[model samples]
Target chain A: MIEVRNLCKHYGARKAVDDISFTVNDGEIVGFLGPNGAGKTTTIRILTCYHPATSGSARVAGFDVLSQSIQVRRHVGYLPETVPLYPEMRVREFLRFRGKLRGLARGERETCIARVTERCWLGEVVDRPISQLSKGYRQRVGLADALLHNPRVLILDEPTVGLDPTQIRETRSLIRELTRDHTVILSSHILPEVEATCGRIVIINRGRVVASGTPQELRSRRGDGAVHAEVRAPVEEALQAVRELANGAKVTADAADGWTRLRVEATGDLREPIYRLSTQRGWTLRELRRDAGSLEDFFVRIVAEAQMQAPQ
Target chain B: MRATVAIMQRELLSMFCTPIGYVVIAGFLLILGVLVILTEGFEPGQPATLRNAFGLMPFILAFVVPAIAMRALSEEYRSGTIEGMMTAPISDAQLVLGKFLGSAAFYAVMLGTSLVYPILMQVYGSPDWGAVLSTYIGLLLIGLFFLSVSIFTSSFSSNQIIAWITASVVLASFAVGGFLLVRHVGGFWRQLIQRANVMGRFEESALGLFTTGSVVCFGALAGLFLFLTIKVVESRRWR
Candidate 1:
């Protein structure tokens, strides 16, 4: 539902987003992963038509962000990082105001307000002013406002920032539920939050997209395929045997209490071959394990690599 | 148009919900009342003309109107609610018009309460009804001009106090500067200042001379400031 091509945004000499391109398909929840100052908010702002991109183009729901910004805004519901809200307005009143601004009919506006208030768990404080609500409730109200018009796409920037653990879980599940009918692009620096909710992740760093794929695909593609083993044998002998068995393998060994801990980096799983070697050598195997790389590791490695490649 | 009305409705509702609206209305009426009853010396048998009341309007609005209008957009910016308004489907012109209408409605209310003077004049003495009507029409025009200037200043800053001060200075240049500086200059300069003077046009209307030139002049000034406000709002996307 959203496509960006070679987007570059420059604020004077500082580039906030540079030559970044990514797409979010319909009915998919894509997590936008990036650290602080990773151009996440800048990209979101451009897509939502709050600001114009300096170069390149973006389209949301088949409408160009620059030319048809009003249409893009109509189709995309945005919840900014700071959750812009009128403090003096009651929850229901604020949602109704947003509903009217989105051009909802009178009957539809009432029903939508009621539905969003229920879905966002804001029924209890529907009549209270927003300033009187807690941060979690305010965030929920922001979510409710975004969903008021039932737009096709939702772009949320750091949706779970201020919520407590329970609120965060509820928000995650709520977002997961939204993916059934709406396309969602959620941006956050928290790794596990994205991992738990998003089917695909796009990691951005220093104004560029470094990696984009499913969490499992990213983990397997950039993962360190290694076997770690601790054998009750001479450190040098075991290291030499493992090295001879797997050619071109990088082996690192450490000796502690008469046991050699070997980390072998090679293609494919080497646990079976290492097991046979321990049996053939008559050496007791204390620990043998294959490493499954995690999304965190992939994120860190990609961001570090991007930073290294960035012009200094 | 519906979007503009919706925004105006919300702005008006929010304004009245706070204590500022009541304070502004009461404060304006109190000051106008004191000026008419005490300083201007009104007796029971005095003539029912509201010359003193309408005479001070341009000067009074120079300060009071900004106080009413300073919070229009500045508060929205400070509280971060401008994001919500801007991200809505409404265009910048619609937002500016909506806010202007809301602030105009508020100034109308503030101006409405002062009509008691005219009604009282009609009861106690024979006042020129034409002059009374024209004076009110003039007040509304000047109020629109002052409110537009205040809204323009409010758009430039997020600080309400700074918005108020900036608008006050700008309006003072038109209201007070014309009279104070006209005496020091002669020939074309005096006429130029007099032409730009808000009080000069207002005095023409208060004297029951309803000229199209004065009407168009006030309309043009308000339109100019509102246009500037729209430009400032649109410039935010780039800057």
Candidate 2:
């Protein structure tokens, strides 16, 4: 439902968003992963029509961001990094106002308000002043505002920031629920949050798209293909035997009092061979757990590699 | 139009909900009353006239209107609410005009309370009704100018204090340059400054002379500032 092509945004000499391009299909949740100042928010702003792209084109729900911004705005619901709420306004009133501003008819507005109030779990705080709400509720209020118009696409920038762990989980589930009918583009620095919530991930660094794919796809790109195993064997003998067994494989070994810890890199799963080796060597296998690198590991390795290669 | 009215109503509601609105109106009234009593030389049985009441309006407006409008967009910017607003379906013009009208409406409320001064005049003496009406017209016109200037100042930064000071400084120029003391400079420079004076634009309306030139002058000045405000707001999105 969204298409961005070679978008560039510059502030004088510094480019905040480089020539980036991406697309979001209907009912898919996409995560924008980047550290601070990585142009995540800048990209979101361009898609929302809050700011103009320096060059190239962005279309939301089939409307051009520059030529048809109003129509684009109508089709997309946006939750900025900070929830823009008037402190004095109560929740219900604020949502109602937002609905009307989106040009919802009277009855339609009321129905949408009620629907979002329930969907975002805002019913309890419906009458509370925004200033009195907890961070979690404030985040929900932001979500509710975006959903009130019932737009086909939702763009949320850091939807889970500053919330407690439980609140973050709740927000994640809420976002996941939204995927049934709406396309979601969420930007966040927390890798696990994105991994748990998004079907696809787009990693950005220094105003450019570094990588974009499914979590599993990005993880495979790390090329480590390494599996970590904790084998409780005679410290010296097990390390020597495992090193010999995995011929030509790079194995890093760490020996403690009783057990040897080893990381073995192979083209594919070596769990069966490693187990057979341990048995043949007559070593006590106390803890032999296979490790699959997660999205966090994948993200850190990529970003750190990029940073090292970057010019000062 | 519906969007404009929605924003205007929200702004008006926000103003009335807080003590800032009350403080502004009460402060203006207290200062106006005290100034009339001290400068106009009150008499026990004589009717009150807006002559002294409106005489000090230009000076009061220099600060009052900016104070009222200082937080309109500046606070939204500071608090990051502007991001929310910009993401909304409302156009840039709607946002700018809404804030301008919201502040202007507050200024109008401040001016409306001063009507008590004229009513007090009727109770004491037969003040010229025509001059009183013209003076109010003058006050309203001045209000429009200050509103636009303050809204434009609000666009400069997210800092409300900075916005207030900047707007005050810009608005104060009209008061200072228009003052007779400044205009009375014994040189050609005085004549030039006097011709450019904003307070001079208020002269016809205050004196009960319904001059088209003065009316046009205030209207154009207000329009100019409002246009500037819209431009600044639009430019900020790019930056």
Candidate 3:
């Protein structure tokens, strides 16, 4: 479990992470979604105790990041954005080293090393130096290192950044599998990656959390609720009928090739009522659709809005 | 703690696994031998003593110790492995101590190889065993002080070359400055230089005095630098 309350981190005048709060329950995979330089990594660093928050507080597994950082670190495993590895250390040797730092006894360290090595699919290159491994394998090594201690909470910042499509899928499944025993907080700009794997999504922009919800909840409940209806009817008549159906919501009409394309910003799902009205009007319906915006729309909208709010 | 030992072992492992460890050892021995031969401490008709060779240690170590410790924390910062290291449920003191001890252990190995020269003195002439022991003890102490200084500089940046240059410059001041500057000034400045300068303290040890004051000086200096390194590591997380 993790809880962040009104956390703020500033670099001189620049606020890297503004006042933001979000909670993640045990065994839940929460995706921290944001574009470049949107404070996603900054927030993760605070949670992992790599950097202290400028203000407020964060707790992981009931331990404060500031006071009980060592305990917080023990409960959580982090795969940093860079995924740095010692170029000279062999894969197995690196894991063994990580295990030691995690305070595993000799026998337990060896067992955990083998288990993580096998789990992360680092079998072939176990004896090879890290410098020789490809990007995908390096990412796997980072993953394997994080899982070496069998930490209760896993924080991965862009876990699949350099991986090819297959590797990405494998990593997604790997993260999903980890939810059985670990609470995962995955941060990434990739829409589908978060959409596919995370149980809940927290969208941040310009050091602020813009929206937070499940994928389906986010898709269903946002952004103008615009319904598009193309009917071969007179503009004035259809506009009047749609305005009546839409009630107080905004309505716009565009006539093209004897068909009036009506866009009604309905307060709720008005597809059923709009269909009946279109039938009653005896207008030939060419296209009738309600826009259920994707997470991509939400992501782009938040970024664009944040950029406008803070301009050079 | 286990974390500290693990980090220390890894640092030592890194040195031996790469050519850096062997190169540093060989390079130090070559330089020390060259300096001794050039000073003509081994020529005939002169008193056979390792004092001249021992006296040049601070100057040699002004370069050698930095080379050994330049990559301690700077490389980790550059490669972004500091994140991995700092997040490992270990304290800053553990990280700094681990690195310091690792470099010190490597220095011990480097110093260990040169011990044969002292033994060689045993074969040829009746070298003052007191001065030899005192000089070696001083060398070990001053070596750690130089290492601590280098490790401290290494914490300031991600560039190992920059760390090496910074540490070398600071140490070369202490190594070359005391002998060069002490005689020019009198009174408090002279006492200060003699007290602060590693070579000045080594001169006392080489005279077979083996003063405890010099041990305290080097020990306190090494401890101060190690403390500063821990603070620097903590400072990054704070501000």
Per-candidate local distance difference test: 0.90, 0.85, 0.91
Candidate 2 vs candidate 3: which has greater DockQ?
Answer: 3
Go through the candidates in order and give each one's DockQ. Answer: 0.75, 0.68, 0.73
Candidate 2, superposed: residue stretches over 4 Å from native: A225-247, A251-263, A274-285, B44-48, B179-197
True contacts kept of each: 0.69, 0.72, 0.90
State which candidate has the highest DockQ.
1
Q: How does candidate 2 score on lDDT?
A: 0.85
Q: Cα deviation of B46 in candidate 2 (Å)? A: 4.5
**lDDT (Cα, 0-100) at B5 in candidate 2:** 71
Output the better candidate (1/3) by lDDT: 3
Choose 1 or 3, whichever is better by DockQ: 1
lDDT of 3: 0.91
lDDT (10s digit) by residue, model 2, range A17-122: 9899999898899999998999999999999999999998999999999889888998899999988999988999888778778888889889998899998889
Once fitted onto the true fold, the runs of candidate 1 whose alpha carbons sit more than 4 angstroms away are A229-248, A251-262, A272-288, B119-130, B181-195
Model 1, range B147-195, lDDT digits (tens) per residue? 9999999999999999999998889788888889989999999887777
Candidate 3: which stretches are off by over 4 Å? A223-291, A310-312, B119-130
**lDDT at position A164, candidate 1:** 100
Instruction: Provide chain B's TM-score, model 3.
Output: 0.94
* Better candidate by lDDT, 1 or 2: 1
Per-residue alpha-carbon lDDT of model 3 for B108-216, expressed as tens digits? 8899999888788778777778788888888898899999999999999999899999999999987888889988999999888878888878788877878889999
